[model samples]
Target: MHNDPSNENGILHSWQQNAEAWTNTVRDGLIESRRLVTDRAIVDAVLDGQPRSVLDLGCGEGWLVRALATRGIQAVGVDAVPALIARASERGGEFQVASYEDIAAGRLPLRVDALVCNFALLGKESAERLVASLPSLLSEDGRFVVQTVHPLVACGEQAYVDGWRQEGWTGFGTAFPSPAPWYFRTLASWVGLFAETGWHLCEMREPLHPETGRPASVIFILQRH
Candidate 1:
């Protein structure tokens, strides 16, 4: 319904304005299923010995934070939207309204055991900067987990026009409707980004769709080197 195609910032503002409704709709349908498998995989990879501190970047509505808390980890959620932050705070985790770039500028107040970034970080520049800043925020041996739309699928080259039918969800979601260029990098590019940024790649897994059982995503787990 929102169609402002200026830049990444503009797209983000649009999301902020419509995020609650959009995310709720997503959660009630396809995203909720994908998240269950993705979140569990990330938690299993990073949450060891009841980590006392964790950080969720681009935390929308604090779902990840609340999930971590239920596992006994002290989690904090950060996002750029005030409405999302407010909703996140009411769910029991500490919420901060701050951009990822702003958070990267200053040292994190605590050495977090893990940092999880879900299907957030859409902008190329911001994603690069956040990826580069992870080493400083994570404790030694800490893990950084990320799950995003597969570049091969999101880029204009390949279209999943009919795959959604097989996967049981309507494929009406736009990959990049706005002019803000998304960094749909290949697997090598993704690995190189972290390697150049001082993080050691540990594991990379692509999960299959629940319905079609076809590979639908690429998930990465990295550790500070």
Candidate 2:
């Protein structure tokens, strides 16, 4: 949770090291909640808008990009981890290696009708900068969509106060690599973030697990104001 220079490096290192393991596990349906609920929520939100081209920020393993392709939507996937991007490239989609800072600085050269960040807005600094840059990243009428772990469920035993959180590798077994750091923000803070960025929250929904009835993730569909 420490906001030091090493934190970002640590996160990238962990993901890089764990890319193949993470990809293999996710592809094999290791996380049932994501496979069943959150994944569908993200795809449905984008399809409902019917965007011609989509930019998937921090798209891991290119699963979502592949899914979108099957639906006739062109998606460009970008991630900081080279290994993940490589795996994504092998999946037959346009994948790029760009950090969140690259996107914030307008270094990534592309524009799309919609941008999706699926469980990828990990840190406060990057998240803030990225939100501020969304106006330039999307088309005039494009939407910014993000699906994240529901604060209520994500908070679990931790304090609701916004801060750094080292992910628990418990669910992925020992084969998983280093734990990554992510910021935990309350629902109120999430709302405030978009509002400060001059983006309006046009739609919001909590994707719930059909069998357990527990919310898996929260989707926020936003528009430039």
Candidate 3:
């Protein structure tokens, strides 16, 4: 019951506070179901693109960076939370403490062959800005891939509409910091955002959970026109 929308830095502060726990959970394979299914789907699509390098935007603990590097693909990670960025740096990947806002302003300092965001696109405002900047961040044939909680699956009992909702953080433990504010956009809204932001939706996929046979997340592959 500690929700405070007035705190502009709430999301960043929460991640900063929960960085160690978050890193540990991810590295320990706490969400292994996602790592095995959703992550594999994304990595497969990324490799199919055959990019020389990639930008792992909002990369929490650098897992994707390391994964791509193992394939002989260079990847750089960027996160707003310094604590997370520090942890990612320790994992032997190039990382920077840059916010999505900085990336929107063309300050990434490097253009990548591809950009991937894994369950990291949070707020609608920030997401729109980042989408607007994708053209500049990617090479001509570069593709942008995003894997996130499916609106249908994540909405649960809540109304399937565009708005902010709190993440459960169940796997991270109750001791974890404030739940991050996630913007819920319907499937149509997601498609609309891509169209309005100048991206062509090349393909879409739904990664299903092995046991439940329900979508674990939605993946979108987009490109600039």
Candidate 4:
């Protein structure tokens, strides 16, 4: 499959195809990474900023939106995949079907106090374009928080570089198929991308897993002064 997200078999297409299975997997607690560590890590990171309104970019099934709602924080979930957004809407969240292209083009009408992208940035060009377009979508004091698989740990045997990586639905079940290849970015690249887009890295959190004590994900809290 082509590494570009615009391709028919790219990351967005794969998510659209497997939205149901992905929703089930998430709701069922089948993935140990989210079940144990990353999910709460992201939720807590978002809440810590105390934003009244939050935008969950690439939010799947609106889980985070629903979670934040319990605490009286208004949240909206947006994704490029219509199926995922539809599933999220069915779950009673404020969701809209909007691609990164749509967002980058300033189609989003509201500016949010906080924006969260949890393991959702998959393509190289999309990531950069999306980040570059975020300042206008955020309030003056808004924060952009992103949580991704720790690059150092996730790299494994692959050479450390920014390129297309063969996706491994590692430890996932047979129900999930046609896993799409994702762009692999180094930690430095992540920081560089943010910096180049006028975002200052305020805090970086590596939440540890209880069992292995390994950093499960890296959370970057970015701010613009």
Q: What's the lDDT for all of these models?
A: 0.68, 0.89, 0.85, 0.87
* Residue 160 miss distance in model 3 (angstroms): 0.7
Q: 1-225 in candidate 2: lDDT tens per residue?
A: 667767657777888888989889888888888878888889999998999999999998999999999989889999999989998888698899999989999998898999999999988877898989978989988999999999999899978888888986777644875778888889999999999999999999999999989889999999999
Top candidate when judged by TM-score against the true structure: 2
Candidate 4, residue 192: the lDDT equals: 93
lDDT of 3 by residue, 96-208 (tens): 89998899998877888999999888877788889888898888978999888889988899788888777758865335766766678899999999999999999999988
Residue 42 deviation, candidate 3, in Å? 1.7
Model 4 per-residue lDDT tens digits across residues 1-225:
335545424777778777888888888889898999999999999989999999999998889999998899989999988888888888797999999989999999989999999999888888789999999989988999999989988889878887787665667653876677688789999999999989999999999989999999999999985
- For candidate 1, write residues 75-188 as lDDT tens digits: 888888887888667757788887877877864565788888887766656777888877777877788888876666554444432111011123535232223233355667
Candidate number achieving the greatest lDDT relative to the actual structure: 2
Worst 10 residues of 3 by lDDT: 1-10
Which stretches of model 3 miss by more than 4 angstroms? 1-8
Query: Which pairs of residues clash in candidate 3, taking residues 3 or more apart in a chain or in different chains?
Result: none
Q: lDDT of candidate 3 vs native?
A: 0.85
Ranking, TM-score, top scorer first:
2, 4, 3, 1
**Candidate 1 vs candidate 4: which has greater lDDT?**
4
What TM-score, to 2 decimals, does candidate 1 have?
A: 0.80
